[model samples]
Structures are given as C-alpha cells and as structure tokens.
Target: RWSEIDIDNAMWTIPAEREPLPGVKFSHRGSKMRTPHLVPLSKQAVAILTELQTWAGENGLIFTGAHDPRRPISENTVNKALRVMGYDTTQEVCGHGFRAMACSALIESGLWSRDAVERQMSHQERNGVRAAYIHKAEHLEERRLMLQWWADFLDANREKFISPFEYAKINNPLK
Candidate 1:
C-alpha cells in the first residue's frame, strides 16, 4: 500500500487505496507499487499513462491484476509485461527498477533537489520527517514531467541500439 496521500483542490480523487490516506491512492498494484514512489513522471510517463487510459476502457483501476480483477497488478506482472515488450527483465531490469530509471531522469532534468528527488522517488522525503509520518505526495507536477520525459525518451530511443550510458549524452550532459 502507498505510504501517503494528498488531495489537491479536491479535484483529483486519489482513492483510498489504503486506509487514512484520502488523497493519495496506491496503484492498482498495491504494495508492489514500490515505496517512496514519488518518482516524477517524464514526458514518456504521461504518454504511457495517456495511452494506458484507453486500455483502462472506462475501468476504475489503471493497473489491475489478471485473473484476480479485484487486486492490483503485481511487480512480477509489470516486469513480465516489460519482458514481453522486449526489455531484458532478467538483467536487473525488473519493475522495481523503475525507481532508478525515474530518478535518473529527474537528475538529468536538473529540475529536482536531492530531497525533492528522494521525496519523488518515495525513498524518503527530503525533509527530516519519516516516510511513515509524511503524508504529502509532493512534486506531482515534477513526477508528471519526469514520467513524460521518460516516456518520450523511451519512445525516441526504442529503436536505437546504444546503451543508456551512450544515450545519456544526447539526453543530458555529465558535469
């Protein structure tokens, strides 16, 4: 289950994925969604979510488990989808790796501080507050942007043959 939740303007109805967190809802995948999961969405993430909206087909849950329907997707299923999508899941490219992927994106973007980055990753907030006591899902915009960027990067690089390190120069310069 997600560690926190926040309701903004009361417009975004983050469901009660877990109890006591009204605005923050856990992904349909539940506990498997990863902790400190405030990873910002790159452009690629936006596109994927937008694309995924269609697959949702008016369903409430975005990522539902197969054969269960009631529970959220598992990390295994997510990685399996990646494997089918051509990623080498066996090479440490599992679903949990998305945190690193997204964090790398944020650092490359130069739009996030370490604290913000950690908060976004849901690793732990940049602030001194413990993740358990912290209830605010900050950096929604940054996460959105981060995911979008990641999505865009993926889309752009899907056809390439270079390693991510090779692509990093094109996407972001090293200091």
Candidate 2:
C-alpha cells in the first residue's frame, strides 16, 4: 500500500495484515513469511516511484487493478507487461527471474558477503535457533550501498555502454 511507503526515508514496510473491513472475508495478509519486509529503495527506484506517484497519486494504493481502483493488481501483471514488451516470460524470464539476475550480479561483483545477500533476499534461516536471533537491520547499511552500486552499475551500462566490471578492472587493476 502507498501508506506503507516512507518516501522521505526511502523505505517500504510491507505489513503482515490488510484489514479493509472488520470481520470481512476478503482481507489480505502481507508477505507469506508472516514477517514484515522492509525494502530499501535505490535512487533509481525512488525516482521511478516518485514519477509513479505523480500518475498514481498519493492514493491509498500505489497500484490498483485495471477493473477496480480499490482492488490490488493481479499477480500476472508483470508477466503480462513483459509479454506486451515482446519478452517471452515462459522462455526468457518470469517475475521471480529478477531475483536470479540480481543475485548473480551481486554475487559476481564480489563486493558483498553471503550473509548480507541472503538477508536482503529475505531467505529463511535453516536453524530455528539462529533464525530467532537474526536482526533485520543486520548489514542494512552495507545492503543499501550494495543496492546503490547495482543501480549505478545498471545505469552505467544501460545501452551502448561497457560492462562496469570490465571498466572497473581496466581502470583499477591494482584492486
């Protein structure tokens, strides 16, 4: 929901509950993990969201269904959009495929720790005892920097651009 977005802080908190009406059968819950997901918005993400706000307005929800503004968008929205853009979701990519793209880029960059990446991906801890002790803020600062780097890397190589990894290696071989 748009209410959960703190544009000033550049954070989005996905609550665990969605209560539209009292004792209504049509209420929705947040993440399937039953935990709040706090995502840090990168500069590009913020800029895009800012523009989206202009179109979407400061309404209760940022994205609404095409049929009804009050209803949340369908899960297939991204896939449909990709299809419209001439990308074959089945053969090339799916909505969740972004996770793989980001994970591969981040891991290949050799700039972030595995723990930080896992936490940012919201992966569940295998050990129940260890899971209880984990803090959401763990490596948050590093994650923010990592995300910024990723976005910058993308921007630097949007089109007719060199790979950042190659550029960095050629420019700073000592590292």
Candidate 3:
C-alpha cells in the first residue's frame, strides 16, 4: 500500500486494483465509485509519512503484517493495535471509524463546503444527473486545505482530548 503513496507530491493515489468486487476471483478489485481515489496529504501527514518512509522504504510497503513482510497489514491488525492503545474497538471505534471521525471533524470545522467534504470522502452522488455533470476532482484545492486544517486541529487538541467544537468554544469564546 505504501507503493500507492507519493510522498514527494504529498498525495495518495488509491489504485483501482485495490477496489473490491463481488464476483471477481481476485480478493482486491477496485473502488466502490469505480474510480481511482486521489487523496492529498496534509503537511502533518507528509511529516508523519516522511518518518514512516525511513522505516518501510526498503520494504516497499508502508505497513506489513507482523509475521509477513510480503503481506499488507489487515484491518483486524489495526483493531488489535488500537485495543492495545486502550481504545475500545468493539464499542468506541474501529479502523474504518477513523474516516467517520475525520468526516465529522471536517464538517464541524465549518471551513469547508459540503461538496468539498463529500468529494474528499469519495462519497457517490445519488443523483445520476448531478453526478454526470460534476467533475471527479471537484473542490480538490479546498479539500487539500481542509485536510491540512483537520491535521492541525487534531494536533492542537490532542493533549486536551477535546472536540474541535469544544476547543473552539474555549479558545474563541466570542466567535
């Protein structure tokens, strides 16, 4: 999966090959939207990944199973790690839940538009006509800024373990 990351460009191109399919024989297929998802990494993400590169560069995969360097780390692997970190995976959160957390934070930030956030989340438009007209990479620039803001927001609140809304209330009480 690290092969999909382009640290130099601060982007992650989720390959169509990683998408899942119902009837396909191969385990991995393509995206749910049936298109490649290009995620722009924030400055914080780049920094974190830069450090990660040193650890996984030779292996060519960003994360690997503990026993097998050839295999990508499983979702359960992440869940188990989260449990060790004292997070309740069963009720509190799971690996996939991070996306929900990020989406919620992005929405609550009020710095990004709904369309930008939706596009960034790779959510498919239910309206076929609108979907046909909308650009696949719509609001990319804004999405990049939103992602950076999110990472910064997380960094700022990590020590306090407060929600962005709560942090804003304390720091910018009048706003």
Instruction: Give per-model CA RMSD.
Output: 7.2, 3.7, 4.2
How well is each residue in 1-175 modelled by candidate 3, as lDDT tens digits? 6768898989998766664433334538555566788888999999988998778846566776687675656658879989999999989999999989988987776656788888888898888988888856468777777777777778887776877676555444123
After superposition, which runs of candidate 3 have C-alpha atoms over 4 Å from their true positions?
18-27, 57-59, 135-137, 166-175
Q: Tens-digit lDDT track for model 2 on 89-123?
A: 99999888988887877776667777777777877
Instruction: Report the CA-based lDDT of candidate 3 relative to the real structure.
Output: 0.75
Residue 10, candidate 2: alpha-carbon lDDT: 85
Best by lDDT: 3
Estimate, for each residue in 81-166, the C-alpha lDDT of model 1 and write its tens digit.
88889999879688878778767766765645555566554464445656556556575665554445456567766787544444
The C-alpha TM-scores of every prediction are 0.52, 0.81, 0.83
RMSD of 2: 3.7
Candidate 1, superposed: residue stretches over 4 Å from native: 1-47, 54-59, 82-91, 108-111, 125-144, 161-175
TM-score of 1: 0.52
**CA lDDT, every model vs. true structure:** 0.53, 0.74, 0.75
lDDT at position 3, candidate 3: 67
Pitting candidate 1 against candidate 3, the one with the higher TM-score is 3
